[model samples]
Target: MTTLNTHPTTAPATSAAGGGGSLRRVLWAAQILLAAFLLIGSALPKFAGQSDAVRTFTDIGWGQWLRYVTGTVEAAGAIGLVVPRLAGLAATGLIGLMGGAVLTQLLVLEPVWSLLPAVFAVVFAAVAWDRRAESRQVLRSLRRAPSRTP
Candidate 1:
């Protein structure tokens, strides 16, 4: 039998525009930076009841409970974004969160503030697209797992 190609069918290692390797590295750097931002800048402030975060959430008028929930989601997503297997999924989830953020800014807050989340959504979308192959593989494996029914 022929040997299977273990490597993903990604772009060439070296190309005219720098290379796929550099692209991957760039993605990794962005992921790490974004993860750190989510954890330190957003999640921690919400959890700590920092004045700015508190006031923003208070203005949202959904109660402090929503702040805790959003923080928890951001914390979990941030952690996932650094994991190779989970990065794509994390980005996918974060995209949804960012979409919610954009809508919240447009509807509840100032419309111009929506630009921030819109930008975040674009980045997360890029990360998600890059990791699509891995995400698909994970889904396939999950589909193949045996049921635990008695």
Candidate 2:
């Protein structure tokens, strides 16, 4: 009888030699910290209408409503980032949001200002890519679920 190795391979590649695995773990820790910091920092100010956030949004010429929408989205993404099962989806959402932020800054703010959002977009993209396999598994399982149509 033949047996299959059914163990799930959900983790990113990590070399057991030369401390490469430890390095990967460190990088992942930094990524999580960066995501939490950026998202929460962006979200809270908009929710509370802090002076800096309000002024920046005002300069963008969009109504205050945009601020609230962005804050809520950022908060949601931040929460999702810490959840093991949802990090990939959260990172994906953050990438799109940060892309919009970068474009807005490019058009309405100093060119240098756009770089911050652009950096966030890149980091989020990396997170999404690292989790791609897990995300694919999640997608497959969802697809296999029975539809609830009456």
Candidate maximizing lDDT: 1
lDDT of 1 by residue, 77-98 (tens): 9999999778889999999999
Which parts of model 1 are misplaced by more than 4 Å? 1-19, 148-150
Highest TM-score: give the candidate number.
1
Candidate 1 global TM-score: 0.84
Instruction: Give the TM-scores of the predictions, in the order they appear.
Output: 0.84, 0.79
State model 1's lDDT.
Answer: 0.87
Query: Which tens-of-lDDT digit does each residue in 10-122 have in candidate 2?
Result: 44455323345674466478567865775667788788889999998888888888989999988888887776566678889989998898888888888788998888788
